[model samples]
Target chain A: MALWKNGAFVDDAWREIAEGEDPPPAGHVILPLDWWEQERDAFEGSNAPLGLRVAPGVPIERFARDINRFALIELVFPKFGDGRAFSMARLLRERHGFRGELRATGDVLIDQIQMMARCGFDTFQISDATTERLLRERGAPAYKRFYQPGATPEAPVDSRPWARRPG
Target chain B: MYRYDEFDAAFVADRVSAFRDQVSRRLSGDMTEEQFRPHRLMNGLYLQLHAYMLRVAVPYGTLNARQMHKLAHIARVYDKGFGHFTTRQNIQYNWPALSDVPAILDELASVEMHAIQTSGNCIRNVTADHFAGAAADEIEDPRPYAEILRQWSSIHPEFTFLPRKFKIAVNGADWDRAAIQVHDIGYQIVRNEAGEVGFAVYVGGGLGRTPMIARKLRDFLPKADLLAYTQAIVRVYNLEGRRDNKYKARIKILVHEKGVDPMREAVEAEFAAASREFISLPASEIARIKSYFAPPALQARAACDAYEARRQTDPRFAAFAANNVHPHRVAGHGVVTISLKPIGGVPGDATAAQMDAVADLAARYGHDEIRVSHEQNLVLPHVALDDLPAIYDELAANGLATANAGLISDIIACPGLDYCALATARSIPIAQRISERFGEGERARDIGELKIKISGCINACGHHHVGHIGILGLERKGVETYQITLGGSGDETCSLGTLTGPGFSSEEVVDAIERIVNVYMSVRTDRSEDFLAAYRRVGMQPFKEALYETSKGADI
Candidate 1:
């Protein structure tokens, strides 16, 4: 497994705790949604950075109030075709105003990285080594001209009022 | 008729290069078939039963002579020397090798065309009335708005992965030539009491396993809010449409389940929240696109005496002039429909030579503009009446002169089991057989505007649900069978056809159609009443009784 952040592969410091496992004492750690729901008080004032891994079918609104408390949010894809996480990412960034690191994990592919990036996923955890290498080398072969305005505030460069302005 | 600017050109080039890379990765085993299927489909490449089928979009059914010529060239070079014009205003090559797809796309890009979003769950090609600018009754041309939609929907990031494919159609006339009511989103251009242009929007109409007629969502939406309103509807559908089952994933299903009122409320809420600065089109941009679709300047001329004399003398020319020519907004011009459904031939297939000849004819007399109708025919939308004789002669020589534009022989059919993996039975052969049964020119003219649409399966790709005589083909007990429906129409007064009786075998289906036609002819009050008119006047009882009794060996 490789973790890509801010345009390059980097070390993954966060340890994702399995079910029924004790929380780590020192370093940053991520807890599954169910475990975090059951044990919300244990990580109230920890020094290490707190992260949450939100899976599909877990109502994102349940964590709306506490979204600012976490430093990182890992949105799981489960499969590339199941795109519930993409919507979740947009909601977290646009609606909830989560200014923390938004990461995409599980079954992320090279072809989908551009769209994932547009949906506000700043970091990606890819299990496939070949896809990781491709992303590291070419950085998602995407069109520079876009048609839709996404979570980002930048206007499309081809059409509309913003494009007509003098540089 | 909108030509691509530099931005549009570079955008299409970028898409082609990206698809080229995707194809290379698929061939090199970097991506599995499961992963590559959606990507290729987004590029309009489908793995059909025999080979890869490529559907090239003709935006809003408009094309120029150069584009048509390039299509003919592609057919000659990469395909099987022929192409099938589809009901979605696209041309599909039934036999293209996967390896040659990139080259084919490169060829298309030369002519300012690409197959983006032609088959994916994203917004497909935005279709409009075939006779948009040339129609005598049009309030305004819908192509400019359709072009705006084409640009907006192309490569939309959030909408590319929708639950199911989405279709939008626009019509600028009161007669509904574009079949607007049966699309996912139907926009009918209208003028308010104060003489301001806007749109009457309809939502949720579709045909598949579950057929539905769209309901009016808004009586009038201002023209400036077109893109913003549409974006809101799509956003709501993307967030709420069911993804558990592919069959029930269309926005029509979601609209049906949620009811129209709730759906409208949700869409309105989304529309209210959408940022106007990001979604609304500027007036300058609208004017820029509208300038491209302005009708060509013409020197008005009187009716040609020579053409009238020829029509009076030549029976074949008279028949063609009667059925194939449509009224044009310009006085001396007419819209000529080039029938792809020649008697006993495939419904929409045209050879490369035929395509080239049509292009030549269009360049000579039709202002270099062509259109592909949803009925699977081509149109020279701006042909001068004086040049009809020469155009007809060239079309006759090239096997493109079938004078059955709205007659019984102009049947609509899907590429069924013969080509499509989703079809249960063959539809093209059935259409061919029906056309042959009523091949007589006089009888076809007398039958008068009978639209027989056929679909091979429940998907209703051929729009069988809205045909005057709809045919559904299914396999029953190791044999192909067809069920008939009556009195369906895809017009302003749209209605789903009713099933007449039990299914019939392929061999018996044509004769059954003959019996139904005979019943209509006998019971019709006068010659002026067409088949659909008579069917609507008298309900389905007489036709149903006649069909079942004829099957039981009853006398006329």
Candidate 2:
């Protein structure tokens, strides 16, 4: 899988461990939510950075208490049209106040990257070659006007006087 | 009419460019059809049975003369010389080449219009009362709030890929002209005893294979909390609405299964937890939007001698005045509905020439404004009472003065198998036949206010579920069969129609409708009762016996 971050494809430093695999003692690692929940105490002494991979429809509220333990949280979209991850992303950032890097993985199309970014995903895992190529070339088009605020800071107040947000 | 600011213009231009690029990618095979389908639908391009159909948003059905002229140009240049006005108060062009859609989007943007969210799973166009600013009984102009919702819902990042499409309607008048009860979300602009304006919010109402009346969610929501409250509701549905079954994916099903109380609790909890400051509108912004929709300048005057003389002299003009002209907020002005449903004509289909005429009339005598009604008619919302004769003459010249605004012949019919891919049978032909059967002026006027709605299929695009006389066409054993339903209403007293009995073949359906109407005519207490009121009083047994008992007796 290719990782895209900060508007370009980049080499991923975090290694995702499968359910049965053992975690390294000192490297950055990502683990599935179920696996991490079952084996979280085993990595107590390790100083390695931890990340959680959450599948779509998994209640993010369940992990809210332990949210600060991870450096990154990856939200999965099992398919292109399933939007459960979007609400989860917003909840994680806005409601839980998770300041960690949020990533989107699985079925990440070029057309949806901007919305994913707006909903608080800082990184995307692009598996489709066409999407990857398109992102590498033209980049996502940014709309100049937004009517609602999201995880992205949209306003200190513009000329249009509705819902002007303060930091 | 809300004019696009520089930011709004830039937003639409960017979207057009993005769509152009997406179309280019599809042409080059860089994107597959499955991947491109949602993108195209988001821009209101649908691949119908024969060709591509492009649905354009007429936001809250308010348009200026220039925009109407642009639509006429699009119909003449890009489509098949005519456009179909939809029940949602939008317009659809039945034919357009796939390669030409990007250019069409560019044309639409030039007029400050785009098809964004007109289709797809995202929130569709926000509709409002067609007589919003002009209605005498309106509590407030609903278009301002509709425009606010339109902007907030446009390309809404989180709600775009929802489980199913969403529809919202706002009613400002006491009469419920916009059919708020049958929408996914309905807002009734109301005033409290404290004299503060707010909304009575309704949720989870829709018409489709499973019809539902929206339940009241909030007795009164402050005007400022509109966006924030709506966001919370959509967010909850995005997370919890069923995705397994396409047929049961609407918010109605979610509300049905979870029950209204639980759904309300969930939405209220979400609303309570949401950052309301970032989403709800400030008072200044509401005033700013409201200014754009301020009622036109009109001064009340004494009755015009010319208008009185014309009405007294010409029977046609008198009929037009009685049927077509509606009471405006101002005494000297009136609301005129220009019917697209001509006798023996396809419902809602307006030729390019007729569109240009409407635009011209709007510019000259209608306060430079036009409104497309959800009932598939164009409304001149601010017409001078004295100008009725001239306007009627102009409309007659253009074949638009039908004088059947709420009469029996004014039918709502969706483009069924003739154009739609999902339709099981043809709807336009049935509508045409019914209108022809009831074309006689005195007969139709005698029949009085009967709303006949025909849907090509159970999707209810024609809103057959809420029609006073509803016809649902289906395919059975390789033949077209239609089911009739009665007493459905889309007004303030909203109710879903009950099926009269078994289905009839396409050939027998029109006759069945006549039989039903004949029964209504015989059993009605008087002409004052109308079809729905009479049906309510007499019940379906009379009509059912008139239909099936006679057929059973024939068999015997």
Candidate 3:
């Protein structure tokens, strides 16, 4: 049985669909490679970032220009400590400036969610919904940006006290 | 000793509150051991074998009297009434409750002290020459630059979650007392011919299972680009360093595997990109940091002549004066190294009362200048020559006047298996026994300048590999066996020791060390010839023959 499936992230669903499986309502949903080609024109340029989830070690830098035209970049972490995804996220954010939803797709542990968030992850998709409770295990923020808001500073200037200074 | 301005204060206050929240969550089961581990490690809290050990960052081994008193207070109330000074110049408290960590940090914050980044995979408390500001041959005080590195590496983005923990040592003197070569990256501040300050950069030196000396990656890097340049190096390591095995995750292994040329090119490429962005090294900030390390006004005194005559008269004081007193950079002044490694005592363990006595001496006879060496010795810099007699008298009363600085009796030992939960076998008792054997012996002088380092485990907490005679305790089939290694060093040319034949039991280990010392005495070219030089001369033949029963008369 398949352990994980975010319609926005899953390219393969070997099992039967769940009872309350929701379609792509707000964000981009994934389609298999063959299915993607079959439904190519259905993916709108306007509704962009139809995140085509890919496996690890794929150099996304070559497709940087096309990838930015998307609403989200759903990169997969094959396992805990894979680290290749970290470079991918950093390249997208710092180098390519991919703005909208950058979600961690597969095998990413809840323990590493905070680190993922700190590394510019906006959304997390767990593999096993049965063990989804594992997501709130480490440094899970009870309230978003409550006490030390902007503590996860993406840049040094953002962490600086002079961040509010007039140009 | 970077003073906490409002920004630093708020940052620490917020960080403390965040840690406090994390602790509560862990207690309430919102956070598991796995999740709470990194959070706790980031705050310098560790779950050791016993309870909890808090490693506090004594930035570059520089702390004021107020901070020392606060540390003493923590030791008295929260811990076992003593603090162990580590080889990396940090202080470790063996016992503290998990619940009281926040409160302890609150106490630390009152004195401008902290446990921030003391552990975890971050730029650890940047270490430097303990005698930095007042050393006789120092080119410049490296503390200001160390302070800069500390601020930059603390919670640094993109570099925090590194492959493993990183350590950096800086030195400004020609002699590398800071052990710069053994650090992950070493920086030697030097001025170019054009009167511009830069760095002689070295990469990948570390001591563990694999001890390797760093290679010079850059001849000179401009002062303005120091931070950016460091970031570049870390970035290159972060991008390409191995993550398959935890043991091989250090930058040293990475540098060794990939070779220096490629790593240098990658770092330079990153540096070239980072150079466009200024790190804001302003003259005012430099001046501000320099002001914190104010120098003491020295005066001329003729106590040298009086002390010389007394040295010929009193044998005890003369012995102490000869070993303990060091030449100060200023005229008529001398730096005194108070040996904490007394006979049959823990090497670096200092009680609260001893700390108070040192503080008193600092405030009185000295210029309120107290420094802790990497070798776990307390230094009273800028002591007037005339005040040596009074200072010696005061120290003698405090049980700290051990005349064994750089001598055979000055042993460097960690809180081995006896205290450290991670240890598999005992190391302190072995040291205690060795000290007892040579406690009041004339043999100590006959076999001079020996550094016997004993680590209970391979983690090298006692820095076993760097010792001239390294004793590493290991568990062999549930029995404790001590492994002896030879010729390891921590200087500019660092190399891991080669194991010498079979392991010895705890009882036999001390005899093994004594035999080794005895062998050195027998074959040494002269009294001036130290333990390492003699060991290099005869190899490990005498030591092996003396240690093993089968090799009692064996050939090398």
Candidate 4:
């Protein structure tokens, strides 16, 4: 998966471990929620960086207590229209105070990336070839001015609920 | 009316350019129709039965003469010389090519208007009382708060793709003219013992296949917590609303299944959490918006001799004054409703010529202000009583002097099978027929105030659930059928209309309505008791027996 961070694409270093796959003893690894739940004891003493993949319906409170242990939490949008993950991302960042990297995965379209970022997703896993091509061709369509506060600071800050003046 | 600031202007221009690119991509085959549907809908472009329909937002039903003239220009150029005003106080053009939409949006942006969020599963236009600033009974104008909401909900990041469309209405008068009770969230401006202003928040109300009235979520919420509380409610709904079933995805279903108490508890907890983070509305910004909607300065003048003379000499003028004019808060000024529903005409369809005439009159007599009511009528909110005669003459010349504001001929009907892809039966003809039946002479006037609302299908876009006399059009086995519901109202004393009986054929529906009216006339205590009050007092037994039993005997 091509990981988009800040404004450009970068190599994704983390390996996503599927449910029945064995984990490598090195590098950053992301595990499926169910598998991590069942084998959490094996990683209790390991020094490896960990990440968790959460589906839309999994209540954040279920694993909010263990949020501090993971460096990344990847939220999945089952479909482009399925927006339950947006609310979850906000709750994780603002409510649970999870300051780690929030990644958006599955059905990540160019149109949804701006909103996902506003809702606190810092990285997006782009799989759609069209979206990737559009990103390269047009870059991200940023308005810079917004009516509501977001997780990311709008440039020329403190001009919220209004337009930001250019320096 | 609120004017766009630099922020609003720049944002709209940016959106138009982005949509221009999106449209070009769709045309170039880079985007599939399925992928492009939601994007187009967000900009208020709908693929209707005939062609693309563009719905432009008239924020809180408030616009100036300049904006009205621009709408007229669009209708004359881009559409078939007309536009349809919707129940949510927006205007829709029936025919526009997909390729020309970007240009149309660009034109709209020049007027500080765009169709953003008018459709789709995002927060729709924030509607307010038509007589907000001018109503005699208003506690405070609701348009300022509505403007705040309009800005906040524009391209709302998390809410642009919700389970279902959300609607919010605000009412500030003693009488609920805005129909607040039927929206997803309703705000009623109120004051406490110390005379401090706030809001009474109502949540989860909607009209669709499943119609439900919003329940009171809070008796009073401080003015400062408006956005914070609204964010909380929407967040809770976004997280918990059902996505498994499209029909059951509205916030109303979630509120119903979980109950209002649990919904309130969850929203309050979320509000507490959300308030600490963001959504803190600054008082200076609120005051800034409030200043934009301040009442126009008018010097009191003596009553017009011409107006009085016209009322005495011309019966039509008298009728217009009696039915079409509302009391204004400012002395010597009256609010005039220019009816779009003429006898034997399509409800809410306005010709470009007529729109121009209204715009001209608004600039000449009104405070350069115009308003579109949810009832599908244009309003001159701050018209001086002295200029009534001149305004009436212009209106009469333009075929806009319908003199049927709340009367029977003033109907609310959706563009049914004639235009809408979702409609099963035609609604415009039904409305035209009903208006013709009751159009002539004093029949409608004698019948007193009656609201006849017709919807093409059960989706209730026409608000059939709350009409005093509701008509739902359906198709059963290749035949057009209409079901009638009685006693529904959208006022402060809000109630859902109950089904009268079995459905009627297209030919029989208007007759069915007349028979019901006949029953109402006979049983009513006096003409003062309208159809709804009579139905509530006498119950449905009388109307039902007259409709079905008499039909059975005649057929037999």
Candidate 5:
């Protein structure tokens, strides 16, 4: 899978382990919520970068205490229309102050990339070539002006406390 | 009306371009219909029974002459010869091709209009009292705040994919013309003891398969915190509201499942958090928005004697003046309601010719301002009394003058099975039949202010739950039947209508309505007592007996 990080498509260095699979002696690995829960201590002290993959049903609050310890956090969209992950990403960034690579995976579409970016998703795992091409060519077809203040640092801030920093 | 600034203009232009791209993708077979459906819906495009319907937002029900003319032009050029104004104060075209939708949206964008956030699960139009700035009873015009909310909610990243659609209404007058009580979020502009204006916030009130009266979430919320508080409410609903069942997906269901106290506490916590980080509205920004809504510089003039003379001399003019004219804050000017609900006509459909004429009238005599009431009537917010005769003549000439503003014939009906794909039975025909029965002007004037609302199904888009006389149409054993409800209201004292006995067939429903009205007419304390007042004083017992006594052969 190609990961679009920063701006360009990059090689996905982290290997995601399935629910029943055994973890490889890892350089960079993503673990499911159950695996992370069971083997928390073993990976916490590891020298390699660690990431956690969370589904929609798994509460993000469960990882609140250990949120900052991970180098990357992957949020699953499950389907194109289900947007629960967007809120989860915002909570991780703004609420928990997790300053790490927030990656979006599974069913990530070009149309939703701008919104995901606003909600603090820095990397996207997209399989569709068209979406990847669009991301590379034009970069998230966002309306330059925004109404609500999100986790994006590019948001405009004005004198109004509610207003985002002026772009 | 809030004028679009550079930011607002660019925002809308971008939205149109994005929608165009999506449409092109769908046309090119790059995206499936399922993938494109929500995108179209988010832009207010719907595939109805016959053709695609596009609902355009009329923010706070306020529009200017140019906008109205553009709407008329769109009707004449694009769709059929007319458009239907809905109970939400938006206009819907019954016919448009999917391929032509992007062009239509581009046309709308040129006129400082768009269909963004009009449909879908996110926040819909933020409706307010139609007579907001002009009303004498208003403490403060609520449209400015409504506009603020509109801007905040439009393309909100977190709320785009909500479990169910959400509606918000604001009212500043003593009377609830906006029907704030039955919306997802209701804001009543009020002044506290300290003499500062704020909002009395109501949460979870909605009408659908399950009707509910919203409970007060906050007795008073400061004006500065409106956006933060609203965001908090929607966030809580987004995270906790039932998504497994679409029927139970509204915030109302969440509020119902969790008691009011718990819901309020959760909202309060979220509000506190949002205040800390996400949002804060400055006093200057609010003042800036408020300045746009400042009332027109209306000259103080005396009531003309010619108006009185014409009213006395012409009975038709007198009836029109008595029913159509409303009390304006300015002494010499009046708020004139141009009835869209002509007898035997579709309640809210207005032809292109009529629209152009109304737009002309607004430009000439009404300060170029017009409003669409939630009851499906148009209002000239500032018509001088001296100019009434000329305006009336022009309206009458164009078949636009109908002297039934709040009278019995002024019915609210949804575009039912005939036009709506979701409707199980027809509501427009029922409204037409009732309007024809009560077609007489003098007879309607005698009946006084009686609201009869009809819905095709329990969705209550027609707002049947809050009408004084509510009719709910349903299909029973392959036959169209209607159940009657009485005493429901959408005012300050909002109440859901109580269902009357058994259902009635289409043929028998009109007779049933007449019988109920007859009972109210006979037993009312005086001619001044409206159907609602009498129904309230005497309760539903008398009306129930009058409806079912003959069929059952016994009175309980």
Candidate 6:
């Protein structure tokens, strides 16, 4: 329930996978998506990693190895009160090596897109907003090769596009 | 005085612009008080007892005439008619508005001055001997190292938010004037047998609620490792110092809790990793910085028959000359400390007019060097001996010739409760009363070499813990009370003062201090055995008895 999905809370009620078998959401561990708050066993089983995200403090202490065990870290902005989330995503991409789809979910105003992109958040999902096109324009200028301190050195400029994005 | 070179000017300008942007953002609601607090404080704006107080770093307590004028202008433009000089040798304007701070910073930047690192948990202003270059007993001047430290610690990324506020002081004098041991890190410059300059580094020394004298970490640190070694100490402090308990968070506590050996070993390990790094001061760089502090030109002169004749007739001049002035290393020159404690005036305070007058005197009579001493007095370091009579005349005319340098009247007191929010009790009033009480005595010389330091709280900004007779202002049951401590010394071997018995009311504190001094005079073998020396020989019992004579209740 902590993870917002499809513009609302993704109901965590478990659904039966097979007859006489356990539920779907039942075994899915819940996490706040903040880097520090994400638990170790959230994705312990043969399943996709639960998101881990949040803002980082000054001088960003958390490194790539710190979050490397996890498969994905999604930066969550609870409210505009937090700034550590932007820095967290930046550190995750450039420093901590979090390369999975970096998503921005909460408190996603149209204003913070460029800086967020510069810091390495690729995809931003606003919870509810009428002007999606305007927001897209704001998010239009995502990247022209990253200049952040901890970015992957070998990107489109160094590696061919086919090799760079395996997906 | 170090001129504003292009580099210095550019850095100050950048800081000013940054502060201006910060102010604009704060005004536009882009930053909250929590976010803006550190930024504002780093730029020297403090939300104090009433308003924002801006403390301008007077590096090594040296200021040129132009800078003094700028300070005076700051007083006129942004504040009341006066600015208060702090115990740390910086000047603070108590009434600058939050809006004008950026503009005030711009004005300061015009003169190669900025309030960067004046506050916050970073290394505060690096102070050195006020008489760094011109003192009689001199090694290499410590100001270059101080300046280097100033540059390195200015907005330093690693050690900005440490366990607590850090202070560093360097001293080259045999007689410690800068209160070196009371700093977080104190370095004394020394030349080894090979005639190469190095430092005797002391760490974990500071004054707070739990006052402690620093301990030596290394016997000798090569001059090259000055910056790296400093960084190492700070890095070790940042990594290991406790942040849970604010009071027990200074480097002194870490050194105390872990013991000096373990803490020192930790620092050395970090230092070994940081050793021979790019931050090391190159020989050429050292000499280049040293060149900025070269001694001013001195012209030869004969011993003054003019001053001799003036002294023959004027007993006042004779007293001022004999007791107040210090001998200079240069021939036919004397270093004069112009007392700001003019009976009722606040210590270390100069009205705008008074500041202009001092600036005028420095330009006309003395060399272009002026020193703001730790005792809250100003020193004209090099005045020709022949000009002594004229200098005394000018000083007397300006009401600065208070013929009391180390006398009981020369009491050192901080801004206390009046101006500083951190103060527990008022210090200025007590200082004024003490100066007034001792003002009537014709026997000023009898109260020889006494140091009465009072701090409002245990922060020891006034350095009360280091005084020969220390008065600490503490609040008792909603009453402003002062506790008396004895035998506190701030020289090369610094020691924290021990409080004797209970506290006294503000009204009775002056009389108690007098009684303590009277007891010293009565028991001393001779006048040469000053209060400190006498107290060293015969401990605090006599002084305690003297304080207990009139009041029967304090369990003497």
Better of 2 and 5 by lDDT: 2
Alpha-carbon shift of residue B273 in model 5 (angstroms): 1.6
lDDT of every predicted structure (CA atoms): 0.87, 0.90, 0.73, 0.89, 0.88, 0.73
For each candidate, what TM-score against the reference?
0.94, 0.97, 0.85, 0.97, 0.96, 0.80
Clashing pairs in 5: A156-A164, A156-A165, A156-A166, A157-A164, A157-A165, A157-A166, A162-B280
Please give, for residues B1-556, the per-residue lDDT of candidate 6 as tens digits. Answer: 5676654566577667767876886888866786677668879988899988998988878877777788888888889888877767788899999899999998888877778778877789888887777778988788988877876676553455577889999999888888888889999998888888899999988876888999899989998888878877886676567766889989999899989999889878767754253466678877777787887788767767888898899988988888677877777777888888888679888777777777788888776667777787887877887888888888888888888888888889988999888988999999999888887247658768888899999878888888988999998889999999999989986776778778999988888887887888899999888888889889877677777754456664
Off by over 4 Å in 6: A1-167, B27-31, B300-302, B549-556
Interface RMSD of each: 2.4, 1.7, 5.8, 1.9, 1.9, 12.2
Q: Predictions ranked by DockQ, top down?
A: 2, 4, 5, 1, 3, 6
Evaluated with DockQ, which candidate comes out highest?
Answer: 2
DockQ of each: 0.42, 0.64, 0.14, 0.63, 0.58, 0.06
Q: lDDT tens digits, residues B1-556, model 1?
A: 7887787888889888888888998899988888789789989999899988999999999989999999999999999899999999999998988889999999999999999899978899999999999999999999999988888788776677787899999999988999988999999999999998889999999999999999899989988899989988987787788888999998899899999999999899878865677667777888888889999997667767767888989999999999999988888788999999999999989999999999999899989999999999999999888899999999999999999999899999999999999999999999999999897399999888899999999999999999999999999877999999999898889899999989999999999999999999999988899888999999998888877864454552
The local lDDT score (0 to 100) that residue B416 gets in candidate 4 is 96
RMSD of each: 2.6, 2.1, 5.4, 2.1, 2.0, 8.4
Report the number of the highest-lDDT candidate.
2
Q: How well is each residue in B305-379 modelled by candidate 3, as lDDT tens digits?
A: 767666788777787777877777887778888887888988888887787788788878776667788888888
Model 1 bad stretches (over 4 Å): A21-28, A31-49, A55-63, A152-167, B550-556
lDDT of 5: 0.88
lDDT against true structure, model 6: 0.73
Fnat for model 6 comes to 0.00
**Across residues A1-167, which tens digit of lDDT does each residue of candidate 4 receive?**
58899889988878788657778877378988888889888887887788999999788888988899888999999888889899999899988899988999999999889899988999999988888887888766677677777777764334234334322
What is candidate 4's lDDT per residue for B1-556, written digit by digit as tens? 6887777888898888989988998999988998889889989999999899999999999888888889989998888899999899999999988898898888888888999999998899999999999999999999999988888888888888798889999999999999998999999999987889999999988899999999999989887788888888888988899999989999999999999999999999888766444466677878887888988998766666777888999999888988899988877779999999989999999999999999999999998889999999999999888799899999999999989999878899999999999999999999999999998348989898999999999998889999999999999999999999999999999999999879999999999999999998999899899988999999988798898884556555
